[model samples]
Target: MDDAQPITTLSGQIVQMGHLDGSLIERMRHEALTAPAPWKAEYGEFQSGGWWTTSLMNASGDAADVRIADGSARPTTLLQHMPATAGLLACLGLNYMWVRLARLEANAFLWEHRDYDELEQAERHRLHIPLQTNTSAFLVTGGTKVHMDGGRIWRLTPTYAHGVCNLLGPDRIHLIADVYTDDAYARLTKHAQEPTVDERLPTASEADLSEHLATARRLADLGYTAAAEQLLLRLFYSFAMPEGTAYDLIAGLHTALGDAEASKRWTAAKSTLLALAS
Candidate 1:
């Protein structure tokens, strides 16, 4: 994959990827099996209860078997342990990144939604920085598309709608990481370079965000519903969580555009807000 071509998703966002034959993939796999940090559980019934469809890193960074050093487990925090697969990522100068081995079982899927706040903040570290943009895994063992081609490893601004499904017998695992700039990594190691609230607030300026909403609204006003929906996707990709105000505007726009699905979501959201207020 050329480092610059845009990789589009089934959901309409654009992302990119790196060639996967490097040493980092090997190192990560080695560390996954040999490292003492934590064990990634097989996709199956959880011992304690309902379907185990999603796994998350807590405020402390510890999962069922995973552990983040220094407890820097916040969603946007970079993990720095040198796993056996470190070389692949390091060779690309992605120093502040970490590896995640995820397994999504048969028929299992992730809904269409962007990553949460912290991860979005972490992503800012890679934003618009050419060399540091991230990619995902395109293949896995077993020669299967589910493990391989079905899910793409891309560095897209997917704060827009995106989803995945595992139709294969085995689970789907992804090695997710971000590109690290020399300056960013240096600052990251020192805990001094990450984006601040001031930086993020301005970077994700309301003007740019509003432009997206306005574009969608304009398209709807002109009767170009599909084009408007696509514009809405771009806005969603710009933020992990499109704010309540953004959602409210989207709801009205979609309603006017005759998109009941979107209107229903905003209606429910308003209902929830009303309930909270009452």
Candidate 2:
């Protein structure tokens, strides 16, 4: 593959993956909703309970490597059990790196975060096929809310900070695939649909920023530091802040609380998390 051409990043967050059979989607949804598969809860420090994932395909052949990757992939029993779903994957003909079924229970949230930051430099993308979802379940990316409707695959460039939420849902489930750029994927996405912005986040005024910082400081003082950090991190989805602004906010919050060491740690994390150069 030629390395000169820069991998295309969508002007907006979501893009359409080509069509899929509606019946297949319905069947997959039924299996997902009824299956007794072991759903592993999300273990990251940033999120609350209710998010779970089970792998269909991954690099280590272990369902637990939920993190993004840039290596060879293999399917797990979860994929084999649903032959129809495996058939759907075969139709795409793309070089997949990882595949999983992610379920978010009612009121669950994947707090604002960036992904693939720890992975090696490569042209990779995340695709979501909503198996079973409700209107309340949606993704916020680039400060725009998107509810990925069924019948078409949805692509998300997750390196940019984004979050998922299921405010009120029976259970939102999606077939998630991470694929590397290849001829098949390039051709499949050649006609990528332009993203429709459901809502654009309003720009925050200086006063608003100050108020938010104060709120975070109060939370930190109360010893709810993680909650404080999440409050600031969520600002990325609510305001049109520059990249890494959330990290900057957390660092500032620590500084205000007279925690120089904590402030310094967050300052360093900002660099490590947002650095574009591999």
Top candidate by lDDT: 2
**Model 1 misplaced regions, further than 4 Å:** 1-14, 22-27, 30-82, 95-99, 118-153, 178-278
lDDT of 1 at 245: 38
Score each candidate by Cα lDDT: 0.38, 0.77
Model 2: weakest 10-residue lDDT segment is 1-10
Query: Which regions of candidate 2 fall more than 4 Å away from where they truly are?
Result: 1-12, 42-49, 276-278
TM per model? 0.39, 0.83
Model 1 per-residue lDDT at 149: 33
RMSD of 1: 14.0
Q: List model 1 lDDT by residue over 103-145, tens digit each.
A: 4455443423333323333433322112111123122101111
Q: Of the candidates shown, which would achieve the greatest TM-score relative to the real structure? A: 2
Candidate 1 residue 165 C-alpha distance from true site, Å: 1.0
Q: Which residue pairs overlap in candidate 1's backbone?
A: 15-156, 24-88, 27-84, 27-85, 28-85, 38-65, 136-153, 159-236, 160-237
Candidate 2 TM-score versus the reference = 0.83
Q: At residue 25, what lDDT does model 1 achieve?
A: 51
For model 2, how does the per-residue alpha-carbon lDDT over 114-210 read when each residue is reduced to its tens digit?
Answer: 7887788888989999998888887776656778878888888887767788878978899999999999988988888855536666766667778
